[model samples]
Target chain A: MGRTSDAKERILSAAQALIELRGYSALGVAEICKAAGVPKGSFYYFFNSKEDLALAVIDEHWAGQRGNWQRILGDDDPPLQRLRRLFEATEADQRAGQQSCGTVSGCLFGNLTLEMSNQTEALRERLQQIFEAQVDMVEEVVAAARERGEVTVADTREAARSVVAQLEGQVLFAKLYNNTRRLDALWTNCLALLGAASPGRAQEAPVAPAR
Target chain B: MGRTSDAKERILSAAQALIELRGYSALGVAEICKAAGVPKGSFYYFFNSKEDLALAVIDEHWAGQRGNWQRILGDDDPPLQRLRRLFEATEADQRAGQQSCGTVSGCLFGNLTLEMSNQTEALRERLQQIFEAQVDMVEEVVAAARERGEVTVADTREAARSVVAQLEGQVLFAKLYNNTRRLDALWTNCLALLGAASPGRAQEAPVAPAR
Candidate 1:
């Protein structure tokens, strides 16, 4: 039993790394098993198919990410500050990823959404649920900000969606240009999206556009 | 001569549709050729490899999209209104795509960036140029808006990047949810991002947050 569980762990870790490095449709079970250092039979024993393995990877990634999000968003900081922390944390994470991988891997969910969502109903549904949950989490913070009169947006849900969308979009650019600095604009952009006045240094920099 | 050019056009069209419906990696030369109803010989006659074909697709799509963007952004409307028109055109495009294909096939460049940027330098460079051109076009309009005191953004380039990012992000949601309605928020979000006081009826809606 111990050995069997160990093999499963190895496969999951290897699959997740490979999926992040490349993508789902480009991967094969044989390549995943080879990278995992497990035999072909071990793969079938653990996953019914490559899609099954992808679902496991998605769930595992979201579990960790959701925990991080909840901690940051649910903290004791003022609602807007908490949102700032979320953006800061996101940039830090992307920077760290670039350091380790030599290139930003981008949001796994966003990557998969573009690559595999339309190809598989299972992935599409799972990605939809995950994004909805993300929007829900952001909406909670925006709602809190609204109650405190920090934000003037009429629709917290739409505001939250736009914020998340901005994050994904900036991350997409970061990955494309291989630059984490692309993420630096998130906090200011977030504040603007919610119509809240910037608190310090006005977080809203009005420097001349980069020539 | 006409027959040869016709075959190439067919291959390009088929590849773009397939790339939009699925993605680049999951496709094979033979499959694209089969879908084009052209012989595999015709494919190799026009393109060297799948990567080459992808570059052609990217270039071809950009050629047409760039023309549309120039027309809309260069129109005689107020700078902000041109921006508004761009967003509305985008939403209408997505809606038409959803209606025709039963799913919202997102921005082809964005979809490819998330799916292929890290895997290929050639693709990364091409996608970077495409996005930069997009930002340049938007920055022109934004600078015009700034000169008119229509927006308070500090950096027109950064503001433009954020705007493009928002568009990519919203389109991702539109594709993931398979719903074009997700794009309806683009114009409102654009005004917020630019810090421009929305004109007429105040595009800033302080309505109740969606439940």
Candidate 2:
């Protein structure tokens, strides 16, 4: 059972990486199995089809992301400060991806939504649910900020949606230009969207990681 | 020669439609030819490869969009009003797409950028160039608005980028949810981003088309 679980984990990780780098349509189950070094039998044992594996991958990916959001947005810092830290962490992750992959891959959910939303109803429905959950998380943070007087928003739900959209849009540009600098404006713009004060140029700079 | 040109036009139109619905990676040359009702031999006669055809499709699609933006954003209205009209036109188009296709397909450029930016450098470069031109158009409108004191923005270039990102991001949500109503807040948010006044909700609603 332990070995069985390990095989399943390997398949999911490999699928996520390939899908992130290339996209959902450009990959196939055979390639996924090859990348995972799992035999055909194990692949079938783990997933019924490519679509099934993709669904699992989406769930797994969101679970990890949900944890990250909870940690950053649910932190003990001021609500606005937590918002700032959330975007800073995103930029850091994209930079790390660029260093490893030679290009920044944008959000997997956004990528899949663009590629598969019209092609597969099942995938689209799953992606929509994931996005709604994400938006809910952002709305919670925005509501908290509003209650704390950290920002003034007429509608927290719309503000939260805008935050997700802005982040995804900027990340799309980063990938399109193959330049991480495109993301430098995200933190400031996010605050501006929330009617918060500018964090000052010095603090807006992407923090260099300690070696 | 006329017949040959007709076949080429058909191929490009078919490719664009299929790609917009399904995405760039899922459709193939054979499928594009079939949808166009052109033979495989004729497909190669007009374009060298799928990549070549895709380039032509991107150029053709952008040419049409460039015309729309110029007419709407370049009209003889106040700069701010022109900006509002531009987004209003976008909402109208997306709504039309929903009525026809039963789903809202977001910006083709943005959708392709998410899918192909990492896999193909040539396509990425083309998309980046097209986006730069689009941004330049927005910057010109923004600079004009600034000169007229229609709005105050610290950086016109960044402001234009934000507009594009925000619009693309919202359209992405519309596509993801298959809900055109997700776009209801675009014009208002756009005005807010520009530091301009809301046009009031009644006017903000997409203007009904004249018969």
Candidate 3:
């Protein structure tokens, strides 16, 4: 049982790394199994198909990412500051990815959305749920900030969407140019989108993440 | 000569359609050739390899899109209004795509940026140049707006990048949700990002294009 479960974990890890490196469509189960150092039978024993494997990968990635997001957004710092820390963490994450991979792999969800959304209804639905959840998390922070009068927006939901959209867009550019510095504008852009009082570069000093 | 050129155009159209429907990686030369209704010999005569075909497709799409952008951005309207029209056109284009294809196909360049950028240097450079051109055109309008004191952005280039980033990001959402209405927030978001004085949803009433 231990060995069997270990094979599943290895396959998942290898699949995730390959997906981040290339993308979903170009990947094959045989290649994934080869990379995972498992046999072909192990793949079918675990995943019914490549799409099923992709769904698993998406769920696993979101589980970890959601945890990070919940921690950052649910922290005790000022609401706006928490949002800022979220952007900083995102940039840091991309930078770390670039350092290890020699290129920005970008948001796996965004990459999969562009590559696979139109081809599979299942993927489309899964990606939609993930993005909706992301926006929901951001909206919570925006709502809190609005309550404290840190930002001025009539629709916290739309404001959150714009902020999240900006992050995805800048990350897209970062991946395209292989330059993570492109994301440095996220905090200032976020403040501007929310109509924060100090929506100037002068106010965009990076803050240490609390916890 | 005319027949040969016609075959090349056919291949490009089919490849673009397939790329939009699926993506570059999952596609094969024979599949593209079959969809194009062209002989394999014709495909080889016109393009060197799959990557070459992709580059040609990128160039052809950019050629057409650049013309539209120049016409919209270089029009004799208020700079901000031109920007607004660009957003409207983008939304309308997505809507049109959804009507015909039953899904929002999204910006072809953006779709490729997320899919192919990390895998191919040629594609990465081409996409980077395309985005840089987009930013340049937007920066021109933004600089004009700044000169007229209509927008209050200190760095026109960075501001333009942010605007384009917002665009790509929102388009990412629009594609993922398969809803073009997701883009209606673009003009308002743009106004906010540029720090325009009247940045409110009430001010986002759609305006007809000035040709």
Model 2 CA deviation exceeding 4 Å by range: A197-211, B197-211
- How much of the true A–B contact set does each candidate keep? 0.75, 0.47, 0.57
Per-residue lDDT tens digits for candidate 3, residues B1-211, read 6899999999999999999989999999999999999999999999999999999999999999999999999999999999999999999999999999999989999999999999999999999999999999999999898789787777778888988998999999889989898898888788877777443432231111111
Is 2 or 3 the stronger prediction by TM-score? 3
TM-score of chain A considered alone, across all candidate predictions? 0.94, 0.89, 0.93
Position B171, candidate 2: lDDT? 89
State the lDDT of candidate 1 residue by residue for A15-34, as single tens digits.
99999989888889989989
Candidate 1 stretches with Cα past 4 Å from truth are A198-211, B198-211
lDDT of 3 by residue, A130-187 (tens): 9999999999998898788777777888888888999999999999989888888888
For model 2, how does the per-residue alpha-carbon lDDT over A44-97 read when each residue is reduced to its tens digit? 997899999999999999998889998998888888778778888888888898
Judging by TM-score against the true structure, name the best candidate: 1
What DockQ do the predictions score, one after another? 0.62, 0.38, 0.46
Pairs that collide in candidate 3 are: none
Q: For residues B83-195, what per-residue lDDT tens digits would candidate 1 score against the true structure? A: 98998899899899888898888999999999899989999999999999999999999999989978777888998999999999989998998887787888877877777
Give lDDT: candidate 2, residue A141.
85
TM-score of each: 0.95, 0.92, 0.94
